[model samples]
Target: MKNSKLLIIAAFFSIYFIWGSTYLFNKIAVTEIPPLFLGGIRFFTAGVLIMLIARFMKISLKLSKSQFINSVIAAFLFLVYGNGVFVWALKYVDSGFAALLASTQPLFVLFLLRLIDGQKMQRKSVIGVLLGVFGMYLLVSQKEISTSEGSVLGIFMILSCVLSWSYGSVFVSKADLPKNYLVSTGYQMLIAGFLLGVSSLIFKETWISPLSWSNKAQVSVTVLIIFGSIVAFTAFNYLLKVVSPEKVATSAYVNPVIALLLGWYLLDEQLTEQSVIASIILLTGVYFITSRKRIAKIKVTTKSQKI
Candidate 1:
């Protein structure tokens, strides 16, 4: 029991920190490789590698018919629409603006859970979501968003991605997925990757050999496959089982702060006072949501023990 709790904590930390670092790496990768192709390759490679590891560890990869269909649906919602469309949208929208829009995941997840599963929202969750939105707004410079040349269609696409991701997150929590997280994730990634590959072909993206990619781009892709896909995504799936979807979605709030800090460290970007304040506020909101979930978990465990 203690080990399970410890693993959950570790999983949260991995998603919070590791996924944050993926933004810069993804930016680098998508610069050279086509967005759809990049995503396809990244997820495909990660899925295969993870599945292989699981097999070596003697984990069953079998899936029932329902489980297979559920994995496919999740793959489409989470990876295909959620990520693929966002990648394509990046061409038309500024990254800062896109990040701001994607940060709406918690709000979307909150209402989706309520509407779909009839879960009631706590007042603290509502306050936390509001604070998170405000903090995200401050984190990205308003001047930048206003000045950037973003297409209306692109903005709409990203909003749709946010909705798809939020809905998928909630759906996965209730879906009849495989008993093993690794098996389910592997299938999800593989299915999404194949669909993305078809998208690349449809768009007529010329395949570039991985050997020809720049050292930095290669490294970025590697990091994304390992940390972003395997570690962080697996952690996210595990969290959905234990934590509230709203709390898991709070990672979106932290990701922008991580990007900003990375920008400061790597590119020497100015860390404005507003950015610092926003980070604090964003983290505080995350704390509130996470603490609420943690308290709920403790209560449930205590009740079970008493029974």
Candidate 2:
């Protein structure tokens, strides 16, 4: 593909709009469908679709046993715990609020590096972490949200999901996997979907026919599977190859804003003054963290769907 201006714009649109829209979509779907089951169907269908596309494109699907194992591990951490649980939290948390919280992923990544890798925090990263912590406090301390039942638990779970995603980003950086990232993503999705599907059953979530789903749930799921899971990811990879890493990385800052606006407009989600202020402070912190030299690889390795 040529590095045409129009192509770049479209790719950015895919990553920014499609990914931001996913938060709203998941929120809509989870109102009716159980979260794990919703995750199962979305990822499984997306996995199959991506794998078929890979095959059609003549990309090799073969992986060594160890690679397959690593794929499963990545899937478990990233998709099952990170993304699936995050979706479950949407049952209680507003989509925009969750998106704002999830933006702290880069902070978690830096913290993990400091803990596990013994990497010294850069001055910028330190500042970013401080701001991120402060912003998070502001975000979660709202009286309206605190009064809502389950919102606190939902916020806690979403933060944990961010940690899971951060850990997975570190894992994928070192893990042996398929030569092609799309193939690796496909493998991860397939394994994660199956695991979450079984978990849904183990947890006794009711499964219903797709035809029985509410119109909104069905549309949301379709958008999630096709645009959120597949198309946005592909565009992310494409942009990384064609543009500067810094430019591609802007999605992290842009996504929460888009999510906030979309949620307010489409779902009638509240956008408190604290939330607006928190979003700015948090994204500023994220910018500081991601602006450093060490954070780029983690951004690249993190899932197409998550923080």
User: Considering summed lDDT, which 10 consecutive residues are worst modelled in model 2?
Assistant: 298-307
**lDDT (Cα) of model 1:** 0.81
Show model 2 residue runs off by greater than 4 Å: 1-16, 141-147, 233-254, 270-277, 294-307
For each candidate, the alpha-carbon lDDT, in order, equals 0.81, 0.77
RMSD, each candidate, Å?
4.4, 4.8
lDDT of 2: 0.77
> Compared with the true structure, what per-residue lDDT tens digits does model 1 show for residues 37-128?
99899999999998998999999999999889889899998888898888777777756557667788899988976776556788788888
Error of 1 at 270 (Å): 2.1
Q: Give the TM-score of candidate 1.
A: 0.91
Best candidate according to TM-score: 1
lDDT, residue 253, candidate 1:
86
User: For model 2, how does the per-residue alpha-carbon lDDT over 99-180 read when each residue is reduced to its tens digit?
Assistant: 7687677666766756655567778767877777687678767765533479889889998998887777666655677878
| TM-score on alpha carbons, each prediction | 0.91, 0.82
